[model samples]
Target: MSEKRALPWLDSPPDGFLEREQRIKSQKQVNIDVYGILRTKDVPQISFEVVGSTGNIYRTIIGNVPFCDCPDVRFRKVQCKHMCFVLSAMDVPSELRYQRSFLPSELREMLATLSLKRKLDTTTPTTAGEKKPVDGECPICFNDFKPKQKTTWCQDCGSNFHQGCFEKWRAAIQTSDNAVRCLYCKLPWKGDEPETPRPTPKAVEPEQRRSKMKYPNVGDN
Candidate 1:
């Protein structure tokens, strides 16, 4: 939802703006590029690398105006898809909606609160579905999991994959209408929870997996 209050350098979009933004999002016309988010010690404005259908990275900045350096936004001077995506995802508070840009310090403060949460949650017991560590094996490759690599899991079939292997499987998928399906279940990624829990493959040495987790550089979002 676009608010009425405008930022210092931004103006309220013209009529039909929200409708147009929703249309583009529904059509999936824009792509959030790999290595898209750029934050540095140099500039205050965070840069986002967004790609259009043509796969060309567009220069977009997250500041007061949250601008896209596309000809459509440059020449036509309208709200572009890139700006819409960030604003929608960021969940800017109503009271803080008109800020020029969010500072790294602000994000660091929020992180501090999360750090406190980790300590508090240490003694708290969790359920099997939450923070349930899988085994040190890549289901896709059926190989030993490498350290400092990204991984994602299929909640439906309870299968995990190294992010690279997952991408390869997803890329090689030949499905009707090119749908995004779970590699293990061969079902659409989006679905309601099953009434009966499906049998999950046993993760080899599941409890013996290391707890010393270290995040690696995200190759893509």
Candidate 2:
């Protein structure tokens, strides 16, 4: 069998192309906020909704035909800044970022290695006490907060909890009559009102293929 080829873009890249791509990858202005990732179980594909620096959202996909719906890729037929941002943020290897196509196994491996950085929610009201730094074990899960892990703070006590663990912990005790309370101090979470229950999603048929994961942009703790 013929050796599997990769990185077709490098065959004849423009002068300084690699350098420009590297700058894009490291530029802080290339915001990746307000994005969602879709990974399918049946198909070895990962899709991203990456928000660009100008506030425009672009679709970047990694599959047999890696693609980005952006002017640079569409018009110039080159890897665009958004594509570079996605690959770099997802920790794709420097050598593999310019690959023209990806294999099923390669896609699966990329998904397995993906590490998302959680963003902080600026809208959450600041509590009375000094905001504590993210440290120590989550009161509910008792797990140490990994760097950049999603977390929410107790408005009353200023203690922090893993976002997922806090949601589960809050749900168990929150009632219509009572407000959600801090797990550590038992003080009523000042700004955290009882959440309205969401309607259950309709069941999917067995024959219908569904995405394995949909990762939302949950900003860091």
Candidate 3:
């Protein structure tokens, strides 16, 4: 399973406390569910007031870019869950959905779907008989010219990396940072189907193994 990084916004305080305070002062408290939070979009602003079952209301602000009236945000300049929750509620763009809560299996499936969607979305208009090659070079290693080789290219941007190069690059990137996107480029490989995690062998039952064993059949023959 890939070790997912906590989104900066989820761990740090939101930005601009005074500005957030003004915004929160105008809005009312809202209810959010877990899944609902994931689907929300980025809005102009979001404010969270935690009354803690008690009457004491603690209010904080989160924006698309995020601003909060909390000291942590002002001093440390980081995003807090309040910001993440608000952003999720706002249905922020995928680029901004910083938190990754999906399990490895779920992430793999998501990536597979994303890969397919990318392919379909990027398919150029062409006749059935004609296969046209889009031209582009790798921005990282610059192994651009593989004139005679049939290579798998990125469906989103027509960037082509040699299959061998891609494999080597991915292997080298396996340990740089836990689940950090490859330093060579922004491409993420940590989520690749985790090598079927090697199974731990259990102790064999002696009686069952002895009973099931097959002896030479020469005597019966």
Candidate 4:
């Protein structure tokens, strides 16, 4: 009977492995000297496994990342030198760090956190030179409507949405409420009012004709 054997590469990777792989693959060269760094062993020991050029197997332990120069990693997608080198440099043993897969919600939270951080970092107060008057013409109307103009602002998204566009946009969304803001641009507009019943016009009564005064003619005769 043949003995059962384990397949070499049947495990899933960590959260950022694919992105990192793509980025690493895009790079022409990685300068981390895997052998030199591994020899010192000052930092964490990162185990690397890579297939090098012409089927050469190169392995090195360095910093928190691992590097490999094998043909599998470089020419083919089986395994690459850069990934091995990065793994070795990072001192991640074969199994522990690979289990760090993030859920969808966790990934969304991470992305949101990153976006918030970026926004906060870029939130410098505007200087006097940066302040500009709102003199530009409206792109939709092809006419200048200053800031002081009595126009409804879109609350959902702060865009200079025209009133006509707002009405059309609101109608397109098909809401029968008394007032509705546009779904697309978020501009506020009044909805159709409940029509009051108008009274019908009445026919005027004909005035009674007065009899001619025959008494005046008798007095004259």
**What's the lDDT for all of these models?**
0.45, 0.55, 0.35, 0.33
By TM-score rank, best first, the candidates go 2, 1, 3, 4
Model 2 ranges with Cα > 4 A deviation: 1-16, 29-43, 115-221
**Cα RMSD to native, each candidate?**
16.0, 12.8, 20.9, 32.2
| Candidate 3 regions with alpha-carbon error over 4 angstroms | 1-136, 177-221
Report how far off residue 6 is in candidate 3 (Å): 42
Candidate 2 vs candidate 4: which has greater lDDT?
A: 2
Candidate 3 per-residue lDDT, tens place, 75-122, comes to: 666544444434433434445444423323333343344234325423
TM-score, prediction 2? 0.47
Q: Which pairs clash in the backbone of model 2? A: 118-219, 118-220, 119-219, 119-220
Point to the candidate with the largest lDDT: 2
TM-score of 4: 0.19
Writing each residue's lDDT as its tens digit, candidate 2 over 1-221 gives: 33244544454545556875776635422332223445565335667655444434456777767787767788889777776666665567777777777665667667666532222222234656746678765544434679988887766656677776565444333211235666455566743334567534345521121112222222221
Model 4: per-residue Cα lDDT over 1-221, one tens digit each: 43222223337764555565454444322221112312232233334332222212244332223233343434654444355334323333555233323233322343344234324312444432232233443322323455656344333343343454333333322212234553223245322333344333234211111113211110111
Q: Candidate 1 has which clashing residue pairs, if any? A: 64-100
